[model samples]
Target chain A: MSVSALSRPSFSRRALLILLSVLLIALVVGMEQLAPLFRALFPDQDPAMYERESFLNLTLAHLALVLVSSLISVSVGVAAGLFVTRPAGREFEPLVSTLAAIGQTFPPAAVLAIVVPVAGFGFIPTLVALVLYGLLPVVQNTVAGLGTVPSQTLEAARGNGMSAWQILWRIELPLAMRVIIAGVRVSVIINIGTATIGSTVGAKTLGTPIIAGLVGNNLPYVIQGAILVGLLAIVTDLAFERLERRFSFGESGAMA
Target chain B: MSASHNPTRDTASARLVANRVLVTLLCAGLLAAWLLPFATMSPNRLASGQTVGLSEALSAWQAIALLALSAVLAVAALRRPLPRELAHGVVLLASLGLLLITLYSLGDYAQRTLVEKSPSARVSQGSAFWVMAFCCALAAIDAFQRASSGWLLRLGYMLIAGGSVAMLFASGHFDDLSIMREYANIRDNFSDQFITHLVLVGSALGPALLIGVPLGLLAHRHVRLQGTLFSVLNFFQTIPSIALFALLVAPLSALGNAFPLLGEWGIKGIGAAPAIIALVMYALLPVVRNTYAGLKGVPPATVEAARGMGMTARQVLWRVEIPLALPVMLSGLRIVTVQAIGLTVVAALIGAGGLGAFIFQGLGQYAIDLVLLGAIPTIVLAVIADFTLQMLVVLSKPAGTRR
Candidate 1:
């Protein structure tokens, strides 16, 4: 709120982190656009691309997989997180966190293979696995991020006669949004890569080109997918950092 | 502690209705999905008379034993008065066993298997084994846990509750490797394959961490280079190890072509060399990110105090910052290590070798037993690696920090 606070040394850190990020982003775009150059240099190589599917559809399908699965995961996971966090259900928090961790460590691709028979191939099966895979970070982060909200703030909200829902919506969630975002950042980035395996079961996404390239042994296609995902991850991370700084206490002990 | 665990003291019928029913339903849903082979796998596939070998049967038994052991410990954790020592011992043993198991499995699987199955088989099977192994592993870890120990012990209770779930699913297990082999159309050689799977996954992690840590440190220090380098590494990570390998294949093959020395070192386009490079490259982002985050997280005050007291920047950093930053750094390493173990399974896609070979091999031929040989151990390796690294992070945390 104060001008002096806004002008702290951290502003310089922010600028530096941003400037480098822009440079890297430019490098990634340059790489994508200059593929023809690489193709020429490596004369034996075929240019990387999809034959049947347009890149737009593939990108949309990829986004849908992430959005739908993450939405489902976050809805249930956050509900579970909020439920376990409350007085009536706080005791079950441990049970919930363990299940989440197990879900996380559970191999999504392997599960995808097994689930293919029951769920059938393509989007649904991959959706199921992605939902399961994405659940932990969201749920665990929700619980943790909320739990770390200052006790005084929560109590004050409760004392003001805020309904439990109101308290959650108005108080805890806003405070915890930074960590929740962090978890989302992690889940999103991981999903960016993990989604590539979806192609194995016939789920179309950017991963399809990469896997097709891998199977067909085409380097440029693989590079294209890798480069896209890498850029997506970097961009999301920087966005999250900016959001965290905007939303979070500027210095919450700076160490812990 | 036993006082807190009075499940018997609670209104028994109410507890059953409120908790047990939901868990049962959840388990049933999960099991119904997992047991398609029993419920819907083709009889024609079954009629081919695929048989389970005695070895595989024994291996499944071993898996059961480990699961049962975890169950017993869970029960004990809930009811009896466990001395602090045994609980602490469980944590230590679980931590150590996970590491040792992976290391041993890696060595075994790394050396080519007689069956021509590669290392991914081991990684996949390792993950499955640990799902049970570390569930029990974490379950029994009632000691030395702060925030999570309660959950760990509660997991023990959940595992105890799983008895009912395990009972419902018991028939599924009863069918044995022979039936699975017959239906899936594969050989029975169950136990050895599972064991081999375990070894491959367990061992791959050592190499991942071995290479990941120093590079992480380098990224942490070179802040100026962080942007390009981190993005490249992150790119490597995001591509998935399988695709990364495809990209690497031509380059590796080219190198192998140009330099005879590279060829002699098994550094060709396919197989282990490409696999390792891809895995290592995939490893860099997490390691580096964690290192940078950890190093950056050192308290400004602490550093300032150290420098104010007449220490060089280097000295102050080594003494004041690193020790404090360790917990977060190790946490990052923990994630990367477990991830590496899991990804190694997929590396089999590129002929990188691990437990995935068995899973893929089974998928290729529809062999359930071989799939189990791969899938189970990969899961086991996942559990073990996860818990072991988790324990390390916990141990490294400031005394009394919960979790």
Candidate 2:
């Protein structure tokens, strides 16, 4: 029953996904063409579009930042999660889990702000902040997902003469993949939002226009930036939904 | 059975010989103290400071005493079987002592050297101090975890440590520090901003609970509604908080313009209204999801038993289901409250007066201390909210179900 449900992409969802993607692309590519509309809305503001950098360039930059940071966060987070769960490193589990929980209580903005004093400004600090903030969800989910794998299954694999490494690679990881992917999805979405704030520290992202707009009180510019960012988030979320469903085999029900 | 137990006992004894986590942390702290600068002494607030090593910051005897205390901590951790509680006690006390001594010395150094030289001279904590402080905190937390399973014990420790720090602040020991100077400068409005931040969180939370609980209850009653409701809420959650705040500007302003009364009622584009609305929207997913899950989690048998006892549907829900679900629902509330506290900081971008105003203001002026002025309080608030709600969740567990 679940297998068939996983295979098919429902029509409305598929259409909505494509439609959002198209809209995002159109806005990115043709933001300038909407200037008259923006001007109509905000007559007091001159040059109603955010013209310092094109929307396409900003969107690409935003995605690139999130991509690099998410990649690093996932690998490092997953490694730490795996390490603490193993017999040789099991003693560190309490500390690692505690740190992950406490670290997340910090707001991402404050994390970014604090990093500035030590790492200085620009891309590296932004990257460091992103990875730091993004690490928590992935580590937590990886640990949680791996823990859900039954001990009996591990013993069964051992009975079949599989090495510890083989059991982890072939059985444990596959079983935990869905939860791990869900974590990655959350990390990516958070990074997308956080990357916008990266613009404040001189790492250019879609937030540039919005920040500039807020500072300058340019309503049109704010709207344009907000529209693109909102679309990107929705589109990315939909993509993850599809990916999560694909990995949902064997699980009784989908996790929200 | 004796033969099988022998190996397990041997391993347990081996484990007692060394706590590798604490040993590693102590070593790292010591290394950071030895290798990096302990503090920076700047002539004035704007100019960058020269780094001062631990040897420079404190006299040789004081530095040695500090290092000796750290070594004692490491040794105590290694001798884990010296009455397990005593070992943990030593670790905890040593770490706390190290922290207090380091800060006190730094403050003493700042008072005697920097402030005497120039009234405006600033002493900023350096990388080494931060690293040492972090290590001490983690070590203390680890020791506390090992020391007891009771929340009350942990709470006692927290209160002692927190009270000591508060007393230190009251005594003006850290007034020479740059961050403290920033605080002294903003002391007047600081409380106001802090109150504003709390108000913002409360405002958002009140509406969220009011709306989200019913939505969740509705979703629970109708399986079909659950799917659609969750999907819509999830969609709202996906939108970045910043973007959502900005996005609301257009329609909100238009609404205010159309109805002048809303503008008069403080429903403008770039203020508390949009910020609160976005926060409530972001909060709904956790609130609604948890409520629905909590209600659904009530065992059918329990509900049936309630009905069999001559209870009506409403009575069964209020008496049986809601009580059973309280913990889960409170956990969700915990998430919402913590998240709102953090998001409210970002709402400062939209001219909502809060601690984030200080943060952004400091960012604009390139003042790290000013940024800390805002960021520190924000973190403390979030942590407090998280801890308190976690306790509430634990307490809310139906008495029979609680561990």
Off by over 4 Å in 1: A1-39, A45-49, A252-256, B1-42, B46-239, B285-333, B361-372, B389-403
DockQ of each: 0.27, 0.56
* Stretches > 4 Å off in candidate 2: A1-11, A252-256, B1-17, B79-81
lDDT scores in order: 0.60, 0.86
> Poorest 10 consecutive residues of model 2 chain B by lDDT?
B1-10
Question: What's the CA error at residue A32 for candidate 2, in Å?
Answer: 1.8
Residue B130, candidate 1: Cα error in Å is 16
Task: RMSD for all candidates, in order, please.
Answer: 9.8, 2.6
Query: TM-score of model 1 relative to the true fold?
Result: 0.66
Q: Using TM-score as the measure, which candidate wins?
A: 2
Query: What is the per-candidate TM-score for chain B?
Result: 0.58, 0.94
Q: Which ten-residue region of model 2 chain A has the weakest summed lDDT?
A: A1-10
TM-score of 2: 0.95
**lDDT of candidate 2 over B212-286, digit per residue (tens):** 999999989986676568889999999988899999988898899999999999988879899989999999999
